[model samples]
Target chain A: MEVLAHGLGGRTDLPLDAVAAIVGGGAAVAASFLALTVAWRRPRLRPEGGRPVPARIARALDSPALTWAGRTVALAAAVFVVVVALAGPGGEKANLAPWALYVTFWVGLVPASVLLGPVWRRVNPLRTLHDGLCRITRADPAGRWPIPKRLGYWPAAAWLTGFVWLELVAPHRSDPRLVGVLIIAYGAVNLALARVCGRDWFTRGDGFEAYSNLLARMCPVGRRGDGTLVLRTPLTGLMRVTGEPGLVAAACVLIGSTGFDGITRTTYWRDNVDPGSLSAGTLGLAAAIGVVTVLYLAGMRVSAALTGEAAGELPGRFAATLLPIALGYTVAHYFSFFVLEGQMTFILASDPFGTGLNLLGSTGHRIDYDLAGPTLTAQVQVNAIVLGHIAATIAAHDLALRTQPAHRTVRGQLPIAVVMVALTCAGLFALLSG
Target chain B: MRGVRLRTVVMAVAIGVAVTLAGCGEPAAPSGGTGGSGGTSGTGTAKSAPATFTGPSRKPDVTVVSATVSRGKVEIAQNGVNAQGRVKVRRGATVRITVTTDEADEFHLHGYDRTLKLSPGRPGTLDVVADKTGVFEAELHHSGARVFELQVS
Candidate 1:
């Protein structure tokens, strides 16, 4: 019982349920932090523009397998496919929180361009679309496109908006027929925009360019080779930009999570209620877009920080220092849901579908399969998730610091990470135990 | 560096405060108002407190709207009623209920203190008994008005 109360195991009140939540919860935290850190700050020591370059653009474009346009369209198409598949009729519900699916996307996109060393120019979606559409319609897709210095990038913004709409607005409509119409209407909007801007505008935006450029700054200062990078911005500006965005992203995450939860509630339960059919899911979708935009803005801020100058404006500096704030947001947002839905375990265990999703599963006969029952190992799985992310962040931060002198290590940062992780674990354990 | 450390300390303290505040919303003491306690109503004995029921009844009009071995689950269409001639209750008979509302309304049995208010088209159920035995009203309410009713004995 003491272990149940203070340990990662959720609660002694409900023995079976606590087990799953503890392990899984712990692991999720650890994995997310670690993955983000490792992926962001790992040093491959690649040489920057030091290699003798063939002076031809043609030489750069001469990869046999994929033209730049081909790759951009392919990536976009892949994203589209995954989104549709996951949110589609029979697809799993979109619960990509501290979990793998969400982490995977972050991991893939973050390190992809940097690890591969600035392929953004080639895979620029705008350029790809311009080329692809031209070939498809046999029309000239290329013109001297003006790069607007003030214009915020649109690819992530648009994608984020579309996702919000799906989650909030479209999901709530009770009439399947109306939902189909709205989807078609949304597709039309995308098509029209693609037609007007020529696919390149959407694909080859300044966002990824900005990202890659920022990453380049973090490379070795004067190490002129295949493995060096340079930092260049004012520390104050970098700090201001990086700090706000991360916090904003954390806020967005909370909003997004809540919005999705609301949408799910309304669509599956509330809308189906006898009198509330007048509501539409569009409002929720709009809210989701807002949340996602905040996330994007935050992401851009991180990119901006990487580009910012000063040796102290390094990855480890942020990782070791600012990680607690980030982790704090994570705990607040996720725990909100945990508090709301955690009791579902008890409800479902006693009588599956005592409320909500259970009604749909009723088969006259009481089936033995109960999803609400949390086994002992399930606790481990949950905790493992939390633990994994923290560990990953620490490892990543440590690795980034390796690029600098050991004496210069901001030792204070390590304690911050440990304290945050420990506090979170302890609190979570209390919740489970209680 | 010390100043930065101080800021970190302040932030940590802030987080701790927020978490403590959040913890206040944890589940309250379990009230033990669980569903499914059943007993038969004594005929004509109107109790002051809310009525509850268990066991079977071979009566008409008073129906158990659920699917269970105790009470054969019968379908009641929108704005329609089931044939109310006979009802048989089981021991420890929880009147397993399955109600699907096509609109927002409250399903309240006038004789029972319990009432279930559901959203439009949402389905929900609760277990209570016809504890008191007398003429009673099963009322469906909407926006604070009684929309429909069923007679119970």
Candidate 2:
């Protein structure tokens, strides 16, 4: 049904899943292209008007929408709690899966929080309250980061670890209510911790801002202050703070400990029902998350290093070597999902729950992909997900490198990318058919 | 600035209109039961299934087509036409039951056992006999409220 919906032949019904995969996959590649291009061109391609721009600290103080969204989510959690209470333990009538909610929230954050600034600043209650507190106390909340810079990577690590524990270890992967409870609890805890970390967590040093700035060097730095965008390069060195990174380390420690505590306490209950029977599968998922995170971090590191080099040169001289590895990982992980979870293969297509396959848009303009058939899965493996990501990253770097040398356009590399995409699709077709 | 506001307002209006339209269209409710409770087992036969299991009724969208208890076998046929349906058994040891649905729905016998997804136009069955007996509800799930009742000894 999923394959038919995302039919091989292009009809009016249009395979939403396939189109989504292409567009989404394509966009990620495009971002990589922008990054690479910036690197290749070096310092010269830096936007004409915006260079050596003095850091504007005022805008940084303004809250991001993400923070507001988090608060709003926390508010709505009231509804979930009410439902759970009324529904009771034996009340399995309603289908509410919290795991799905967690996936959606984090997935949304990845591109925004990681690739861009938190964007939640405008709506962030914590920031607003922190600023107010600072004003009332007449203290410098911006001087020292509450947390340490070294502890910056812990959130992502914690996120990865949490997924491992919930999906793999604590069992009840199939239980919607349990999953929902976990998400609510996690959110509540994060919010509470953020309150303790205070405003200094962001303003103290380069922290997330630094990582974002490094990410910016990879792509054509978009016009800043042209109105907020879902995507923006992080401000550089926002993460680097001098004094005690204690508060930050404490936050990480708290998160990690809680995750472990949740596992230990829940393990007994899980063992009784024991859904995630295959310990190997659990390990594989953990490994996959680690691999993806490392690959992503590595890609960023390479982009950063290349940016440091002289202008008008190829960015990341060695980035191309990692493309195949990243691509291979994408294929392996996605295929693993298909092999392990028989039901989730066509998840993008069918909303057995009435969600529908047209996630991004209406029927004619959907952007999802059909993972129903081997052919489609192969297409995703080679062309869209894996190879596509590599192409984009490489393309971005190349563009950055070639941005200099007025005569030499990165346009030449476009052909290579096209060829690679075609080759990937062809390879996928062959593999899937075979 | 005008363009941004306009876009936001337009998007909001569009969403509102879509939502309103969605609300207007009524979901296929359990009109009533068509078949008898048990023509095969010589029990009572039902003609007109409830036309609509209206507001907060005990049998809201509920239907129990058949129920039987023989020497060591208990059989029950149910249509997930309503939100909640009930089944009463006389005496059976190892019970085997079958459930069929007219459209795509779920058949979950609450308290007795787990639920299974029933494909459209296809029937799904769950079979379990009593070892420990306390009255339990054989409930069918609708959207909001689930209609069910006590399975008396």
Estimated TM-score per prediction? 0.36, 0.39
Fnat values, one per model, are 0.00, 0.00
DockQ of each: 0.03, 0.03
Error of 2 at A347 (Å): 18
User: Model 2, A26-114: lDDT tens per residue?
Assistant: 45455555555555454222222333333443244344554556666744543544344234232212232332232222222222332
True lDDT of residue A326, candidate 2: 28
Clashes of 2: 61
lDDT of each: 0.35, 0.34
Tell me candidate 1's interface RMSD. Answer: 20.4
Name the runs in model 1 displaced over 4 angstroms.
A1-133, A142-155, A169-171, A195-388, A395-434, B1-95, B98-153
Ten-residue stretch with the least lDDT total in model 2 chain A: A1-10
The TM-score obtained for chain B of candidate 1 when compared with the true chain B: 0.39
lDDT of each residue in B1-153, candidate 1, tens digit only: 233334333433433343333221222123332221323332222322433442343223233453111121223422134423122232233343445555566665442334676665556665544332212233354432222222222
What is the TM-score of candidate 1?
Answer: 0.36
